[model samples]
Target: MEKNAIVDLVRSKAEGYFERGEFFCSESVVHTINELLGWPYSEDVVRMASGFPIGMGKSGCLCGAVSGGSMALGMAYGRKHGEPMNEKMFPIAKELHDYIKSLYGSTCCRVLVRNYEFASPERKAHCVKITGEVAAWIASKLLDDPEISQKINPNFK
Candidate 1:
């Protein structure tokens, strides 16, 4: 499949998940990608996201979206940790994290444009937009074309 093919497939689902809430964001992204690639929408992705959600969203700590992204990235290569000790996986995870950080300014939930305060429906809508964009960008990069990183540049704010 061509690079970014996953984005087109997952964007709508990601947006829909945004409309719902933060809890579904990771599953939407993973499921969308699986459907897009015909890989069978399995619980592994959702479960992995759910597993990390605690460490990630302990009252909005780290970006759960990134954690979800990391989970998906890990599943694609291998289920391990420590920034890719295998040299090959190193570039993948590093590239994913670096790309996300460059776009979101910081993967921290509190810093990613105050997602912690995403209370009102209007504010939540904005959060959804930002999160969907971040998820899409993450999906895009993992699919291969790292250049999509420029599209979300948080510095633009």
Candidate 2:
């Protein structure tokens, strides 16, 4: 498939997962990215992202989508145990973080959704939108990198 189409598909899937209550923001990104990359990590890898929603288990710190996006970045760029550190990991993670921070002035969920009531549709809509955007951005990044793109399913076409 073309790059934009793949990105849009990923965005739609992530938003659907969140909107359907199948996963929260962080889990949706992790799950969608993992699936997009042909599940290099088991789908169970999504468990690691679960606690990230609601800002570190509801403490309201970092945005869950940002956290999940960072984890998705690590899946592509991170080093495994005892291996030499992967140099690309940190910069890419920071790029996602900065992209989010630039958009909202903060990566805090509480701050980002402060204008909407916690359980209101407005708040859910806001989070769902962020989840889709982050998932799409991660998809673009992965597809643009030759090595990572090789891992993505061409069935997206």
TM-score of each: 0.66, 0.96
Cα misplacement distance, residue 157 of candidate 2 (Å)? 8.0
Over the stretch 91-152, how does candidate 2's per-residue lDDT look in tens digits? 88888988888877888999998999999999999999989989998999988899889999
Model 1 bad stretches (over 4 Å): 1-6, 21-23, 51-55, 79-86, 113-116, 145-157
| Candidate 1 residue pairs that clash | none
Q: What clash count goes with each model?
A: 0, 1
Give the runs in model 2 whose Cα sits over 4 Å from its true position. Answer: none
Q: Write candidate 1's Cα lDDT for 35-67 as tens digits.
A: 444453364656656644322656666666666
TM-score of 1: 0.66
Mind sharing the TM-score for model 2? 0.96
Error of 1 at 132 (Å): 2.4
Q: Using TM-score as the measure, which candidate wins? A: 2
Instruction: Mark the 10 consecutive residues where model 1 has the least summed lDDT.
Output: 148-157
Instruction: Output the lDDT of residue 148, model 1.
Output: 30
